[model samples]
Structure formats: C-alpha cells, structure tokens
Target: MDWIEANFTDQAGLAALLLAALGPDGDDGSHDRSHLLRVWQNATSIAGREADCDRAVLTAAVILHDCVAVEKDSPLRSQASRLAASRARAILAGLGWEAPRIDAAAHAIEAHSFSAGIAAETLEARILQDADRLDAIGAIGIARCFYVAGRMGSGLYDPADPPAGRRDLDDRRFALDHFGAKLFRVAGNFQTEAGQALADARTRTMRRFVQALLDEIEGKSE
Candidate 1:
C-alpha cells in the first residue's frame, strides 16, 4: 500500500510537471488535460480488478502514458515514450522502487499506444492497453475519432473507396476505416472480462455510428 501511494503521488507530480512544460493549452489543441484524466480514470477502473497487477505500476503508467505525445519541438520530436520513461524512471527511483518495477512501469507506459507497435507483455501492461483502447471506442471514442481524423485531415467516410486491404492505410482514409482496421479488434485483445465487455459494447456503438454516418452521407438513412 505504501508503494502504491508513493507511486501515485509521484505520478501526480510528474503529470503536473509535464502539463506545465506542455503549457495549459496542450500540444494537439485537442488533447487537453481532461482527455488525459479520462484515460487515467478508465485505466484505473480496469486495473482495480486485476489481482496480479501492481497498483503502483499501473497507476504510474496510466497517468504518464501520454507525457510525450505528438507535440513538442524537434530534437524532442516524437519522443514521448522515451521522455516518459526517463522521467518516470527518475520518479520511481526517487521513491526507492527497484529496477524491475520501474522497468515494468516504463514498459507498460511505452506499450500502451497502438501506434507504438509494441505489445503489452505484462499483466499491468495488458490492463493499461485495454483501458486505453476502451477510451477510443465509446461515446468519448466517437468524439476522439473525429478529433483525430480532423487532425489528420481524414474524411468522415469514403463511400466509393472502401478499406479493402489491411496494408494500404494512409492519412486521407475515412475515419470509419479505423474500425475495420483496428478498433473492432480490441474486444478480443483485452486482458480482463470487464474490459472485454466494455470494448464489445463500445465497438458496437462505433460500428453503428459508422453505418449511420455512411447512410447519412449516401442519403440512405432511415
């Protein structure tokens, strides 16, 4: 329990430090503090039931998961995971966490992102992965889809050009293509039953939303 408290306390401190460094406005204009908070909440909910999971490691991963996001200047460009691990390692070491736990927490944080191409190897990483993926599917997920799509200059739907091959995705494809590509796969990838259920329900909603959007765009909505 003491370790958990210390890890979380250090996590909060790091979050504050990173937020200050990123400024109150955030890097992506869209990824505000509230968004990070939601990811943390979702991760915590999933982490709570995993008895084999370490609370300190999971909590630290959740809070500092996006510390280095897609923002920031060059030299530091696209180095969120590296920067996060460095900072998190310092915090963990300061709290007397041995090398293994610090390494585990850093791995979880680094692997939490789908774009990172790193798979979750630990129980804590699996839980964090599911929780983070859950955030990309629900009502909030819908919002995030458009937010990210807009950022990437992607359209909402492309009726003529369907997402056929798995390997041909580029920046201009429709937002719905993401579901077929990866979002729907999350339900089966979750580590916990609760996380699986949440992913299933959210995936369904996302599918329905995509269908509705397609229908509306095609003037075929009922």
Candidate 2:
C-alpha cells in the first residue's frame, strides 16, 4: 500500500499531507500553520451551516489554500489561488484521492481568492471563499494589515492628510489607507449568511479602531 493508504485509518494523515504541502518550514509567519488552521476551523464551521457541502473537500481546500507562498503585492498576486489549486491537485492525487474529490478541492482553492475574483460554482467553494476571506477582517485582520505594511516599509498614514483627507487612497504608501482600499469592504459582499454576520461584527471592530484614531487626531478625547 502507498503511504496514503497505509495511513488512511489515521486522522493525522491529513495533517501530515497538508504540512508537507505547506513546505518544510511550514511558512514564514504571515500565512503560516496558524493561519491555515484558522481557515480550517472557519471552513468547518461554515460547512456545518451550509447545505450540500462536502466536508472532506472543504477541509482539504482550507489546508491547501495557501500551499504556495507569494508576495502580497506581486503582479502575480491574484494568480496565487490558481497556482495553489494546481499544486493541490497533485498533492491530493498523491494521497489517493479520486478525480471528482480532487476536482472539488481544487475548485474550492481556485475560487477562494479575493483578487482572483473567481465565482464559486459549488457549495464547498462558496464556504471556502467565505472562510478564507473571514481571516482578512476583524482584530486579527487589523494586525495583519499593519504587519504587511511594516514589512513593505509603508508609513502609518500620510502626515499631510492623516485621516485620509485630501489624498488619494494609496495602500502601498500608507497603512491606514488600506481600510478604504479593502478592509472596510469585506463585510458587505460575503458569500454566506454566517460569513456576512461574522464579518459585520468584525467590520464594526475595525471601524471603531479607526474612529478612535480619528478622534484622537481631532482632539475629541479631551
């Protein structure tokens, strides 16, 4: 029997496969093991409420979603999902997955990207999209935004127009501008009811944080 079959009865097999696919070191902290686990939890929770979703496919998709590392602002950023999908197929196939199951997982991975903007064609795909996108919002999302910005050498905000006034929204130059460019828009266009509900709460958290900053700038705290 192949390694997949040998380990078929063991639950840890899935985790082992996903870990290998994620690369030896697991990740570089940004889209690391913790991120994948969070996405997995989110996907499974959404799957519980969604009808007609294949839990196995959704689980595999969540684990393999970020298998390949790509720069956040690379010209190929949007293609990361497509690349990951392609990689997922090979890994699933190696693990003795049937063609249809592999296809379902690959489809979910392909359609989960925000930049790719691909429409999901299956319930599993929709849930995966919603699950992954959820990670990009709320308190954790806010931390990630500044983390990436700092990595890219961006300023906190434009000093001349700190509250995003009188300046074009440019996330590449100012970390604060990302709220207008992307973060603030996630809640309004979710694919599932659960995703939307959670996103709304997270969106509010983000807005409150931004408002506090604005209030401080305007001396409203006094």
Candidate 3:
C-alpha cells in the first residue's frame, strides 16, 4: 500500500506538471484537456475492476497522452509518440519518479494511440487504449472528426466525387471518409469487453450518421 502511494504520488505530480505545461491550446475542444479528463474517467470506470491494473499509471498515461500533440505541425498526420515519450520521461523524472514506473507509464502513453502502430502491451495500456478509442467514437468522435477535419481544411462530404482511389486520398478528404477508413475499424482493435461494447455501439451510431448523410445527398432524408 505504501509503495502504491509513493509511486502514484509521483505519477500524479508528473501528470499535473505536464497538464500545466500543455495549458490552453491543449483545450482546443478537440481531444483537448476536457477530452483527456473524459478518457481518464472512462479508463477508471473500466479499469477499476481489474486487480492487475495500476490506477496511478493508467491515470497518468491518460492525462499526458496528448502532450506532444501541441508540438506537432499536424497532429492527425504526424506520429507524436516519440516526442510524447521523451516529454513524458522528463516530466516524470522531474517529479522524482523512479526508472521502472516512469518507463512503464511512458510506454503506456506511447502505446495508447490507434495510429501510432504500437499496440497496447499491458492491461493498463489496454484500458488507456479503450478510453482513447471511445473518445474517437460516438458523439465526441463525430465532433472531433469535424474539428480535426476543419483544422486540416477538409470537406464535410463529397456528393459528386467518389473516393479517388487510395493514392489521391489525403487530409483534404471529407470527414465522412475517416469513418470508413478508421473510425469504423476501432471495435475490432479493442482488447477489453467494455471497449468492445462501446465501440460496437458507437460504430452503429456512426453508421446511421453516414447513411443519413448519404440520404440527404440523395434527397431522401429531411
């Protein structure tokens, strides 16, 4: 218990420091501060029952997960995990965190991304992964898609033009294509039951939204 307290104390302090460093731009209403908070909340909810999970590690990873996002020129396209890991290590060390715990937390943070290609390796990582994926689905996911798409100067949907094969698809592609390409694929990647359920449910909602958009384009929906 004492060990948990000590390790977790350091983890919490480091997380707070990173959050402070991140400041306002990290709250741009697109997977920003509040979104991180929600991911923390969601991770806690699912991870609480798993005895093998470390609450402190999971919490810290969730909060500092996107710290490097602000540093990137284009977060959606750039792989910021390496930068995030570097920043996370420094932040943890500044808070007096030992090598092992800091290393674990940093690894978890780096592995939490869906685009980063480094899959979840631990139960704690899995929880963080699910929580982050949840944010990329459902209502919040929809909002974030547009927010990011707008940031990247993408269109909402292209009625007349079809997906111009794989070679031409870039950031300029519509927000709707993201669902077909990635968002809809999240459910299959989730490692936990809670994540799977949320992904399944969110995928349905997204499908409905996509179908409705098509209906509207075809003069079917009101």
Evaluate all candidate structures by whole-model CA lDDT and list the values in order: 0.70, 0.83, 0.75
In candidate 3, how many Å is residue 136 off? 0.6
Worst 10 residues of 1 by lDDT: 69-78
Compose the digit string of candidate 3's lDDT tens values, residues 92-203.
6776667887888888888887667897778888888899989888888888888888887778866554343444444357777787777877757888887788788888
Per-residue lDDT for 96 in model 1?
79
Residue 84 CA displacement from its true place in model 1, Å: 2.8
Which residues of candidate 1, in runs, are more than 4 Å off? 1-25, 71-83, 94-97, 162-171
Compared with the true structure, the alpha-carbon lDDT of candidate 3 equals 0.75
Q: Candidate 1 residues 42-119, lDDT tens each? A: 777776677777766776677667665564223554466667767777766875778888899899987776656687
lDDT of 1: 0.70
lDDT of 2: 0.83
Better candidate by TM-score, 1 or 2: 2
Pairs that collide in candidate 1 are 68-80
**Order of the predicted models by lDDT, top scorer first:** 2, 3, 1
Per-residue lDDT over 60-160 for candidate 2, one digit per residue giving the tens place of the 0 to 100 score: 88889888788888898989999999999999888778899899999999999989989999988989898888888888888888988987899988878
On the 0 to 100 scale, the lDDT of residue 219 in model 1 is 78
The TM-score-based order of candidates, best leading, equals 2, 3, 1
